[model samples]
Target: MEIETRTPAEQLRACEALRRTAEARSLDILCELAEHYEVSEDSLIEHLVDRRIQPVVPGPTVSEFLSLELAGLLECTPLQAAAKLYSALRLKYRHPTLHTAVQQLDIEPHRALRAVDKCAHLDASVAERVTTGWLPQQLGLGHTAALNRLDKLVVEADPQRAIERERARRKDLDVSLWGSYDGVTTLSGRLEDLDARYLDASVDRMADVLTAEHPGLSRGQLRAKAMGVLANPAMALGLLQRAAQPALPDSEAPNGCLGPLCGTIQTPLHKLRPRLELAVHIDTNAVGCATGSARIEGAGHITLNLLREYLSDIDVTVQPVIDLATVAPEDQYRPSAALKKVLLLAFPTEMFPFSNRATARFMDFDHTERFRSGRRRQTRLGNLCPFSRRPHRGKTAGVWDVKQHSVGVLTWTSPLKYVYEVSPGGTRLVDTGHDAWRKLDW
Candidate 1:
């Protein structure tokens, strides 16, 4: 299977020889060579014929071939190997029709993988029905809708089994906040409906008050503050007050006062009142649907029920996420609010792609608009264009086409037309993993 290789100079000479113009003179020489070799012109061009038949040996299954490719292409890249391995597994088990849906329906591979995961536990009929019936139709329904439809189909096929499975899932419920590390405490476990609702309300109420007083808190900080307040609002306030005051002398220090130099002192940063202005995109249609799924900025699944319960005490402003469009010269200032919210939501990390560092709140808004200069049409996003501006730019500087993804939760995403990603730096951008958002090199 090994093919001989040639040096660049040798390849160049070969290319020049082969590319000698196939005009009459060139053709005459080629014809003479063919005759001397006892071969016809058709035989000389036989390699170009399209193969309607499968290869004689059929090389290998996609999974096997990809494995070999991965070994060769990613010899030292563990991360890529792990990622591709998952894809290979999916490819191995993926039904032929699912592959067709991916090609014809334009479903992204990751999304198709999700659909595959759903039906993985069920019968082939379930996956087939979804791939054939719902996936192909771009009926303005986002991926959530298609998934929901598939779930409904699953239930209709076997209700008792679905209910039993759901009940079993409900049993895995517990609440825990592990010991703190680096001033961060991990919270896990599930809650009952009433408990979850109460917790959300408590956090929201505290977050509203905190955000109002301190307007610059990012969503994570706001949430942490809210939860801290919920744990013991009175004690939390007292601690804040103590931290705000200057440190006392060694002996004069209060009984519990660790003072300004305390390793964990975070009152100053908290007092600044960081904003929790996260942009959550959700499909409006999926919000209340039985099988609808929502994500809080890409922080895993946040069902509408949970989102409503969690944000009950927090003020929310709903706005349309217009499509990417060119800003007309006539419109004066940019219509900033909506676009800024969308960009921040999409790029929560506020990262400068070049620096590979998180902005933490210092990043500015950049508009990489479509079609300018001497190039073909390009994406209208920050990464591609060398356009960076302060956080709050003109209201509508680069709006060309306004597309509205359905929902607006914390880190909202349209699983179909667009995919949102949360970077290691905590920025939420479109999942540029696939060819979907080539503007971002991620």
Candidate 2:
């Protein structure tokens, strides 16, 4: 245990191993806590129902509160204790795969517990599928991937409910501004796509004009200024008019034209419209069916009928499908725009394990096995995966290693020697704990 003279790499490995051990032990404690807090079958329901009695049921049960004993034992807030109890009970009784994985110290405790919490609203069968089927596949990925996958599963399980929720959400739409002591205010709200698009265009137009006035400001700063300008409709309108004015020769006019806003003063801000390019993936069986679900680009999943209703008011152009299986990989190192689009569509999210901050479209298409120049057929579908900048750097720096098993399927090894497999279907923790640690020495 004495590490005063140990190398930095050795110290890092020791710390990582200890951390994994601590996390595994923590899960064991939570399971024990759940057993301790479980409602006794012998206890009468009438006793708990009494108005004078404080609710003793653990977890997020509507009327029940965490028991004082449980909170005291955990040395945490009642809410925190309750949440812990909830995750433990759900994992042990319901999500067996997650339960075993955590017990074996394969997956992170927080990640597994959060998965339980996200699936709290699901029914028995669907929730079972989530833990036993879908979760095991996505376990290698980060929390955000798990969250997004959970949402997709929930929508697919009950598309009608998702549609209803979307409808109810629309009814709750409201815009509000919060003022802060930092001399700045935050404006945020959800709006219908049509209205939001128009507003976005107006803001961009105004931002363009503001750019001329504030030459040193970033585009984002200019946009923020534009939002303030829009608060005064008359001033905003006059500025838009001036911005739209055609520029005369430099000799005739003192100032040149505004950037994108220069031209056609006749096209008022109100007349501006937004064009959207939307792609929706639908299951073959669910085509033209109310029960089927469709996943929209950027958005998760929705019922087929919900998608129809959403597009009803808009002008939609249908494009022929490009069969990904048939799309052959090009020989060149740099993929063509058309091929890049296919790749992005093929893997919508970044390929790195424990990463979901960026979509594939915003990521670099990394060669799974380092691409060598003049190598024939090196830049192929199975050999390529999307990687974010940080992970890409790590991979290049030899801090992390990757092996592509097949198209969209990859296995990665961390500096700590923990192994994870990631694919479009989900992710899996291939190796971990003391066994993996011991093997490193062997």
**TM-score of candidate 1 versus the correct structure, residues matched by position:** 0.32
> What clash count does candidate 2 reach?
2
lDDT of 1 by residue, 98-128 (tens): 6554444355555665665665555555546
lDDT of 2 by residue, 1-442 (tens): 3566567879898898788777767656665644443322333243333112212222323213222224334544344555666667677666767778877877777777777776666665567676676666676777788778877877887788778777877778789764322235578998987889999998998899888789999989999999977876756866876765655554343245555544344445433335557777787788766687777765666777777787776567788886767877778888889888878777877776544433656688988888888788887789888876656655665555789988988987654456777877665677753453343320
Off by over 4 Å in 1: 1-94, 103-106, 137-140, 172-192, 208-223, 230-442
Reference-based TM-score of each model: 0.32, 0.42
lDDT of 2 at 398: 56
Clashing pairs in 2: 137-427, 138-427
lDDT of 1 at 338: 49
Using lDDT, give the best candidate's number: 2
| C-alpha lDDT values of all predictions | 0.44, 0.67
